[model samples]
Target: MSNLKQELKENIIELLNLEEFSVEDINDNDALFGDGLGLDSIDALELMVMLDKDYGIKLTDPKEGKEIFQSIAVLAEYIEKNRTK
Candidate 1:
């Protein structure tokens, strides 16, 4: 699970071009948007693509994406349970 969280941090930084942040800067409970990581809607869309392409988990509902993107811990858990890859 920790590995998943670390992987997520790396992927997010690379995918979003967040050069200002490092893996240590993000905590497990840190929110991925708004005041947390300061990600915007565009970043969320990129993450959805990542989920589908890397994990084989496609998100059809925006609301569901909102819930899953709450934090690294939550997202890692979801992937652990649902990832096909």
Candidate 2:
């Protein structure tokens, strides 16, 4: 799980093109949107693609992404459980 979390941070930085953020800049529990990382809906769509392309996890419902993407920890957990790649 910890390893997954670290991978998630790295993936997020790369996938989101967050040049200003390093893996250390993201906390396990930090919110990824709004007042946290300040990501918008477009970022969310990018993340959905990241999940599918990298993890082989497909989220058909955007609403499901809300809970899974609340933080790196949660996202990592979800991926660890569901990732096919």
Candidate 3:
């Protein structure tokens, strides 16, 4: 689980081009949007692509991403349960 969280953090930094934020900057429970990482709609789209392309997890509904992408912990848990790759 920890490994998955770390991987998720790394992937988020790389995929979203969060050059200002290192892995250490991201907290497992920190929000990924709004006041936390401040990721907007475009970043969400990129993450959806990342999920499909990197984890073989297809999310047909964007609204679903709101909960799944809430934080690294949540995302990692969701991926652990659903990842095909």
- Which of the numbered candidates is closest to the native, going by highest TM-score? 1
**Which pairs clash (backbone N, Cα, C closer than 3 Å) in model 2?**
none
Per-residue lDDT tens digits for candidate 1, residues 1-85, read: 9999999999999999999999999999999998899998999999999999999999999999999999999999999999999
Sort by lDDT, best first.
1, 3, 2
Question: To one decimal, what is the Cα RMSD in angstroms of model 2 from the true structure?
Answer: 0.9
Cα displacement (Å) at residue 60, model 2: 0.7
**lDDT tens digits, residue span 17-66, model 3:** 89999999999999999999999999999999999999999999978999
**Which 10-residue window of candidate 3 scores lowest in summed lDDT?**
8-17
Q: Name the weakest run of 10 consecutive residues (lDDT summed) in model 1.
A: 34-43
Rate residue 85 of model 2 by lDDT. Answer: 97
Runs with alpha carbons beyond 4 Å of true place in candidate 3: none
Expressed as tens digits, the lDDT of each residue in 1-85 for candidate 2 is 8888888888888888899999888899999998889888999999999999999999999899999989988898899899999
Clashes of each: 0, 0, 0
- Error of model 2, residue 18, in angstroms: 1.0
